[model samples]
Every structure is written in C-alpha cells, then in structure tokens.
Target: MTLSLNDLPLRDDLRGLTPYGAPQAPLPIALNVNENTHPIPDAVASDILDDIALAIRDVNRYPDREFTTLRESFAEYLGHGLTPEQIWAGNGSNEVLQHILQAFGGPGRTAFGFAPTYSMYPLIAQGTGARWIPGTRQPDYTITPEEAAEQVRTADPDVIILCTPNNPTGTPLGLDVVEAVYEAARGIVIVDEAYQEFAPHDAPSALTLLEGRPRLAVSRTMSKAFAFAGARVGYLAADPTFIDALRLVRLPYHLSTLTQAAAVAALRNSDVMLGMVEEIVEQRDRITATLEALGYTPHESWSNFVLFGGIADPRATWQQLFDRGVLVRDVGIPGHLRVSAGTEAETTAFLDALASIGSAS
Candidate 1:
C-alpha cells in the first residue's frame, strides 16, 4: 500500500529561512566579526596538542554524555563553585541558546529580548516556533530590569534573553537590572555575556543570581576572549534543575572529543587568555578615543569592539572603509557601525584608513 505524503503536522515557520553565515575572504582588516584576531600563543598551542594526544584514546568512544569534567573545569574558570549538574556545554553558546528555546519555547509560547541586540535571538525563536517579541531599550541601548520584568508580566514569555555589553552596541545593563529581571521573570532569564571578559569592573554574572532564581541561565562562549572560535565550545550555567532539562533536549555527544580537549586546555591556561583580553580592552579604548577625535561619538564600550555614530551615511561610511581595505560591520542601525578592536598594528591601520576616508568624504 502506498502511504499518503500529507499525514503529519509540519512546522511552516522555518520554510524560507537562510542559515547564518560568518564572513568569508580576503578583506584586509577583518573587524567585522567580533573575533579576537590573535592566535593561541605558542605555549598554549603546545599544551592543547599535548592534551589532545593524551585524550586520543577516548575518541573511539562517545564523549561523556553529560560532559562532567569539562563542566567542572569551566565552572572553576568562571570563579563559581557550580557543580557539573548545574552546567550544560554545547558546540557553542549559540547552540546552547537554541537548546534553551527548543526546550522552553514553541507554539503558544513567547521569547522576548531587546531590539537591535543580537541578530540571532529572534531568528532562533522563530525557528523553534515561538513568538519572538522585541522590547524597548533606553537611548544608550541599556535596558532596565524593571522594564524587562514588566515585559515578562505582559508577554508571559517562556524565555527572556539579555545581552550585557550587548552585541553591536557594547552597552552593559546594570546588575540591579538583572536582579530585578530575575525577580520578575516567571520563566527563564538568559543573560548572554558573550563579551563578559571585557566588561567594565567585572560586571555581576548571572551565576551569582542563580541561588534564588532557579530559572536563570547564563550562557558564555570561549569563542570570544579565549581565541578559540574554531574550537566551537560554549557553556551555560544555571540551577541544576534547569540544567537537567537542558540535557534532555540536547543531542547526545553534541560536543565532539576535539572540542572538549581544546576547551579543557583553554581553561587550564586561561590566565594567558586573560592577558589577551586585557590587550583587546586597551585597544578598544584607543579605538574609541580615535573615533571621538575624528568627531564621531562612540558609545562607551566594555567589549572588544567599539560602536560609533558616523558623520556620513553609515552605509556610505562602510563603503568608504571597504574601499580603503579596512572591513568593519555596518550593523544597519542608522549612522552606526561597530568595529572590532584588533592588534596595535591593525588598529593603527584602521585609524589611518578611517582618516583617509573621512578626509576624502
């Protein structure tokens, strides 16, 4: 007997979606993606090779389904006493966010976050069949906890995501705001600190708020500060119960053996990573100053990149930079572009390029 093809309930929300793509090619200064342009130091590279050599025997077998050891090491790296049970590791924190949305959000549920934040939040929510809602942010791009809490009350969303030192803008939401959101949220409050290492004054981590708020999940990525973008390791820390739920939805052995080995090595020598972060912060300050000097006002950035308002049309400015062989991210926000802070040499090159472009314009 021939079976009919129309027998199932198919999700139509993701019908025409185009997957996310990272930048490709021979652009001179790649400050588009917020990647650390530095390579792993030679000593750290040697350690990673050694760790992989030792862990080779476990490759034939599946990775620990729970990733216990890696989770423990990651928690320690974060200076939090979180047990493995309270952690979830994924291929990247972006995947961790996806798993969260899939587990808690779907048809009839809502996932809310501020507009002009991470470009991926709404895309992920829609792909999971959740209603994606955009909330308002203050003029400085910071959102108050009270505003967030009120949105939660009205939207009754299944998930609320906040990006501190937020993407593209680099403005940080205050800790009191986070506490208020935690108190207000009946569902999950995800604080995505993808740029936490560069945040000013060691901004309060959501892990600190986890004791009282069971639904708070803080997602982090090694891709940024660790110079391990290719390693694809990201993690989520939360109350054990919420973490347990994450495990149920996560694919078994989702983090490959190579990824775990790289992550463990990276965490073991994280002090080296911190040094690079410090350098990037210094570069960011210099870039901000240069932009301000050029008569372009830049937002106070605590991340590895700076966001500024351009004197000309932002698209025109981006084209000018492109023509000058310095690639930056034109975030489509009016008169705004975000430039990733690179090395001292690269920063000098970018400034020179910007100056040439500004003079000609």
Candidate 2:
C-alpha cells in the first residue's frame, strides 16, 4: 500500500509535475546531461584536498556568512572589471536561481523565458509561486533582437531568463538580443551562462553588458569547464543593489566552509583546470562532423555538447547505444538527441556505437 501525492498534502500546481532531470544509468560511456566527463588534474585535486582538510578543522564554527573571499576570487576570475560587492553564489546555479525567484518573483509576479530553454526555469518559478510565461523561438531555435524584445514587451513579466549556448539544442544567442530584451522589460533579467566557459574564446559575455544595467545579472557555474560539478559551486555578477536582494533571500551562511575552500583552490588553479576544455571542444566538433557525415543534422554548438536531428526512431537509437555501453540524451525533442563531449576515449566509443547503427533512411 504505497501512498501517493493525492494521499498527502501537496501543492496543487505541483500535483502532476515530474522533477527535472535526465535518466541516470551505469554505462561504460555516458554523454548525457551535458556534464564535463573530464577529470580534474591530479595536482589541482591534491591542492583542493589540502584546502578541504584545513576547512574541516574549522567545522565547529559556522562558515563565513558573507563568503567574502570566494566572491573576490570569482570577481578576479570573471575579469569584466567586476567586484566582490556585485557577486553572489549558492550551492549550485539552481539554488542561486531560486534565490533570484524568491527575491523578485512570487505570488502574482510572472517569470518569462523562451520555450525549449532550460527546463528548470519554469519549475523554479512554480516553486516560488511565480507564474511562468513561455515565449517562442525560431524554427532553427535562434531568436532575433526584434522578436525577443517584442515577446518581452507583450509578456511584461517580472523576471526574464536567457540561456546562452542553450541546453538540449546547441543554439547560440547574441548579446544584441539580450540588450533588446533588457530594454523592453522593466523587471529583473537573468542570463544563465552555466556553459559560457565552453563558448568561443573571442565571444563576448553578458558581463560586458552589465556596466549600467542594474536589472541584469549573468550567472555562471564551476560544474562544466572546471570539472567541478561534484563540488557544486555556482555564482553570478550583477549590480551591488541586485546582489543585496539575493542576500535577503539566501539562507544564512549557505555555502559550507569546505565548499568555499575547495572552490577557492580550484579558482587559484583556473588555467590548469581549464586546460581540458580545449580537448573537450575538439571532441565536440568531432561529434558534430561525424554526425553530419552520417546524414544527421548537427546544430552549431558553442558548448561542449552536440544536438543532432534526423533520427528515425530516437528511442530505438538511444536503446541501441545504451546496449553498446554508450549513453546519450533523448531530450524529449522529436527526431533529435544530444551528447556531451567526454574524454577522447569516451567520445570514440560513442561515435563507434552511433556509426554501427545506420543513419536515418
């Protein structure tokens, strides 16, 4: 006799909704969920361990309530003339986003994002009691400045979220669109740049646009390029006033001592930690090229994953790859699947497995 949600007290809006996540399975090669499958270098890992051990000694006392040193490190790493006063962080980007919603969105306020964007936007909105309004995207998944501004003007939401180098589909977003959307909306605007470190070197980040725009925020994470997903540190840059708002909503001393210490150690070794990004990018491009040669339409990607279409039966193909011990994502988008760029060996395994299954006829 298993009791379900109907048998218990639950929020009506969340009654039938499922949690946001990808399928987890043990496989020899996993490219799903867009994780950086590369391991951190040994030297950096050793340094992190040393820091964590020291932090453990202070476990009896609460960690820094302001996390001042961590914020300063992030500001230096971002290098858009940012300062500690404008920085905010949380356990992960998701928690940082939750704080935003809690501060600026709730009750009658509405949050807006382009459809087929990050799935968590709506869930976070719902959790904060904010109405989630979904805008549209072009057929190729790109959005122009005019279209984006028009949508924002029409929805007139209290919050707007933009995911650059978007998830599930590897579409790149231009800063012009961000500017236009910001001009059209009177509310808070958040750009989720969790994958920004994987973008092209010359590409300008939204941080460059944050100079005079007090309503804008650019959020990033150590999960992908730094291979720090297990460490769970995410941060954002915004106006000092805006950061103060998140402080109002964030739990007291949210980041643990060990977490701050580990992240600081990683940031200090930023160059060495990011060295793996080049290799991962090579594999990502390789996946794209091989996918096209197989008659699949691979979208141009700035992130470390490729989303391809032209699968005759996505579920069947996914199962075939899984049977071969190679796992990719079927992101619920018809005729398409996504794969993260793993180590060279893992990428080879995925490619071989995909090639064995013939292309869509």
Candidate 3:
C-alpha cells in the first residue's frame, strides 16, 4: 500500500502545504518566470567553463565554509565601499533569506511583507517557526510610505520584507517608502533587490541608503540579470553585524566549490555578462507598448518582466498562450498575467501570439 501524507507524521504548521513554485511547463516561447533566458556571451561562457573545471579538481575536499573568496567577489562587484565582511552568499536568495529568518526570527517572532509581492517571503518566515503577517498594497501595486509605516507600526514584526520591482507585479518600491517602513518597524528590514539591474536609469537602489542603517539589508541574485539561474548563487550586501548573524544560522560550506567558482567567473566578466541588459530593457518596453496598443493595461515596469491586466479571464488567457506555445504566468491576480522579457525574437513571438489571439475567453 502506498503511504500518503495522512499516514505519516508531519509538522502541524506544514500539514497542508503545497509546493511553492509554479509549474515549469516546457513550451516553444516561455516567458513565464522572470528569468533572463539570454545565453551568456561566448567569452564569458569560456571563462566559466575553466572555473568549473578548476573547482571540480578540489571537489574531493570540502568546500570553503566561509566562501571567503566568493564574498570578496561580491564586495568588489557591488562597489559601494563594501568589504568582504559585509557580504554573504547562499545557494540562492531564498536560502540567504532563510538564514536571516533563522538568525533573527523564530518561535515568538513574526515577519511581515506587503502583498501582491513575492510569495516566498511569508513562506520562508513561516518555515523558520515565525508567524507571517500579510500587508496591503494600493490597486496599482504601489505601497505609499504612509501605508507601509502604518503596517510596520501595527505588526511590529521581527523581519520586514520590501521586494522592489516586486515579483509578479513588476512594480518597484520607492526608497522613501523603504525608509518609512524601516523607521516605523522595530525589527530588521530586508529589501529584496532581485530586479535592481533592470530598473530605469533614474531609479535608485536601496543599497545607496546602507550608510547609517545597520538594521537594513539588501538581497540580490545572479539568476535574473546574469542569466545564471542554473548556478543557483545569490548574495546580499549589509552591515558586518548582519552578516555575522546570518553566519550563525547558515550551514558550514553551504555554497559548493562549483557555485563559488562559477559566480566568481561571472562577476569578473560582469561587463560582458551584463551587456544583454540594455537590449532586454528595450524588449521589455516593446512588450509594454504592444500590450497597451492591444488594449491591455500594462503596469509600468522597471524590471525584466511586465504585469498586465484587462484580461477577461486570466486562466483562459494563460491557456490560450500555452496553446500557442508561448507560456506566460497566471499569477493568481484577477484579470492579470505576467511575462518576462526574453530575447528580441522571443519577445516578438510572444507579442505575435497575443496580438493574433486578442483577449482570451
């Protein structure tokens, strides 16, 4: 007989949990996840291969527990007068976030996030035995400083997550709003800058505000802009004190030798690896313009993805795109769907599919 969840013991809090990710359905033109999907330029690819080969030679030995060199690479790349002491790495940003929760949140603690944001913030907090508090955002998905500060005051959570260029919505959070929340909350404030590289030229990163705020931390990842999702490397910049706290919770040698080597190679070739960003930005704007012309309401995006509304039925629209071999995300919002900016050709293909189909159902 097959044993099911009912037959085995599980954590009471996790008894009814479904997995977090959306379906990774394969299709001709996949614009679902907010990934770069652009291949690394040839020279960068060659260097990365060499680094991988070098890392495997030392694979028989345990990896570096502190990932010292990797931390140094991150510091150099970030270039805000940051040092290795303030850098931290993990398998991905998710794991880095888990470290934050494990160090500062648990049991009696609680974490809060403004919703229609990244789904994982609450899930990660709850996984650490901390309660998750959901907050609200305006209809356009922007959270004003007043609303944010009010929520922070009311919940008084231990960890406050601010996801700029928020996932699935693609709307950015303002630095002033971040400051307001930080001032109102008594706990640590984490700014998830996973989409920072894609923001418009005038938009500022919360990293600029790190000077005097010891309690503020900013999270980033290689997966989106670097086209290194398969590498599974993510990192953050923050106070040395914050880094010290995360160290207590992270497993020794958490980042493998291969991951460190690959990430370092990518960082060293940052210019070439990031060369596609401008082109992708163009593609994102093209998508927005096309969507508007096609009568959909596309949110002004500072990220690599566009979130648009005005669909008659999101589920059917998702299916319509899927049927056409162009996949986009049905992010559970009413009358809205999200799609990532792909290569120029891929973007055209997605646009053509949508334009021909019109509103689905």
Candidate 4:
C-alpha cells in the first residue's frame, strides 16, 4: 500500500512560489545583466580552444572531484598561498551559495545581509528554510561596522553574507567594515566578491582575512571578469575544514571537464583578462561622469556598472529606455536603475538614446 504522500508538508516556506528567471529581450546593447561587454579576445579564444581540446580527451571519465589543479591555479593567480583542499568549485557562485545555505542554514537559523544588495541572498536563505534578516544600509549604500555588528549580536544569525561592490547599487563595503563583521559574526561570514576585477586599486580581498577566521568563506566567479558567463564557473576559498563541509553538500563531479579546463585557461591568461578589466573600468568611470553631468546621481561604483536614482519614476524611465532600444535594470527601489558599462560604442548608443529621449521631452 502506498503511504499517503498528500499529507506531507511542502517545507512550509517554498510553497506556491514560481522559480526565478531573468527576463529576456532582444539583445540591444545588453547592459542589464552586468556582463562584461567585451568579447573574448581572439588570442585568448585560441588558447581556450587548445585547452578545451585537451580536456575533451578526459570527457569519458568524471572530472577530478577535488578540482585540485584548477584551484591551485586560481590561488596562484590571486597571489594567495591557498591549497586545492582549501577550495570548492561549482557551476556558478549561485550554486556555491546554495551549498553554503544547505550546510550551515536551516530552521532556527538566520542569515543576515544588507538590503538592496545582491538579490540572491534572501532567496537562498528562504529556500533553505532559514530566517532572512536584512539590515539597512546608510544613505550612500555603505554599511557601517557598528550596525552590522549590532545586527549580529541582536539577531544572532547563523550566516552573514556581504557583497563587496554590491549589485544594483555598485557600492563597495569598506574593508574596515568587513573586518568588523568578521570579528563579530557568530557563525559563517561569506564575502561574495563577484565583481572584484573592477574594484579600484585592488581592494583587499577576504582571502587575507581567512587565516584566523575559520568561519569565513570568499566566493569568486569567472562569469564576471573573465567573461565566461556562458561557461558558468565559480569557486570558493576557505579553510580546509569549511571546504570539507561544503563538499558534503555539493553534488559529485559537479564541475565538468570542459568547465575545469576553461577556468584553468582563463586563470592562466589573467594578464589578458586584467587588460580587459582596465578597459571596462575606464569606460565605467566615463559613464558615471556622463550620468552625473546629466543630473542623474550615480553611486560611487567600483564595479563595472553604475547605479542611479531620481528618474522621476524608475519604471517609466526604464520603459522609455526600452522603447529606444536600450534595456537597463530597473531595480524595484523607487527611481533607481542599474546599467552595466559596455564597450565604448555601446555606451555611446545608450547615451545617445537617453539624450534623444531628453530632447524629445
């Protein structure tokens, strides 16, 4: 006799909700997703093809579950003395976050972060049945140490997530503030540095804070800087013990042989990748300055995007831009929109579109 499955509770939290998916549109300047607008350089493309061909030979077997070589290469590129055992790889940083939630979050636990930051943190927490507590950021979109520490002490969350160079707002959390949170956190503190490549002056990475903080994990993604959004490679750097806990929850042979090879190839040519980053940063500054001149107050961004408000109505402004063949991200925050820095040509087109609209008005 089949047991009555209908009586089972559906986790109680995730019931009646549709899955999240990014909106699709015809690719017009395509600056909504914060992707690097530059295509892979031809020389780099050739190198990646060579590496992928070599990796194809190993396709018959499962990839090294440890992903030792890739992790070591990444550590070397980052100039950190990290071992393969101290790292974990996944399809994307999003998946890595899910693994963290599963390993460290559950009922009676809470995950804390600053609101108007990365949109994924709360979703991940809720998916795991953990309480999500969002602290408010300062008017400038920066978080204060005292505020974060107080939240940790009062809420006593089991996990804390900080996104340096935060999304949709493009503001970087000060290193001092991050260190303060690290000191005060009761459990795991994840520093998600998905946009680190665009940061000014090589801001201190959370990897430097990992020696004493066994509860810290720093997540990175190839999708942003390396322009491998299509490849879907992301990794975490943490203490070996923390990585082991992540290992327990991650699927076996999760990183495909192709992805491993692509990451290694991307890491090996980091100098080329950095050149592209320089270009993007230069373009970002130009865009920010132009937006300010247009009377749009954009946040000081260290990422490859600029976020601004005061468009009268953000949804209306977004609709206007879309009508002009430009697609931008209109975050639900009133009068706020985030636009990625694209190639010079794309930036010019976006500016031209906005100018045209302003002139028509």
Pick the lDDT winner.
Answer: 2
lDDT (10s digit) by residue, model 2, range 165-262: 89868788999999999999999999999888889999899999999999999999999999988889999999999999998889998999999999
Please give the TM-score that candidate 3 achieves against the real structure: 0.98
Query: Can you give the lDDT of residue 191 in candidate 1?
Result: 91
Task: Write candidate 3's Cα lDDT for 1-361 as tens digits.
Answer: 9987867887888888887987788698988888898999888999999999989999999999989998999999988889999999999899999999999998899999988888888889879999999999899999889989998999999998899989878888999999999899889999999999999878888889898999999999999999998889989999999999998888888899999999999999998888899999999999999998899999989899999999998888788889999999888999899999999999999999998887533
Give the local distance difference test score of model 3: 0.91
Residue-level lDDT of model 4, residues 1-361, one tens digit each, is 6754345676667766566655679967778988888998899989999999999998999998888889888778766788777888789899999899999997778999888888878888898889899888888888788987887788778999999888878888877777888888778999999998889775887788888789999999988899988889888899989988987888889888998898899889888976888888888998888887787888899898999866887777788888888888877787788888989888888888777766211
Candidate 3 differs from the real structure by a C-alpha RMSD in angstroms, to one decimal, of 1.1
List lDDT for all candidates, in order.
Answer: 0.84, 0.93, 0.91, 0.85
Q: Report clashes for each candidate as comma-separated counts.
A: 0, 0, 0, 0
**How big is the positional error of residue 87 in model 4, measured in Å on the Cα after superposition?**
1.7
Kindly report which residue stretches of model 4 are placed more than 4 angstroms away from their true locations once superposed.
1-11, 359-361
Model 3 CA deviation exceeding 4 Å by range: 359-361
**What ordering of candidates by TM-score runs from best to worst?**
2, 3, 4, 1
Instruction: State each model's C-alpha RMSD to the native.
Output: 3.6, 0.8, 1.1, 3.3
Candidate 1, residues 30-58, lDDT tens digits: the string is 88899999889999999999998878878
Estimate the lDDT of model 1: 0.84
lDDT of 2 at 178: 97
Each prediction's TM-score versus the true structure: 0.93, 0.99, 0.98, 0.94
Which stretches in model 1 have alpha-carbon errors above 4 Å? 1-11, 359-361
Question: Stretches of candidate 2 above 4 Å error?
Answer: none
- State in Å the error of residue 321, model 2: 0.8
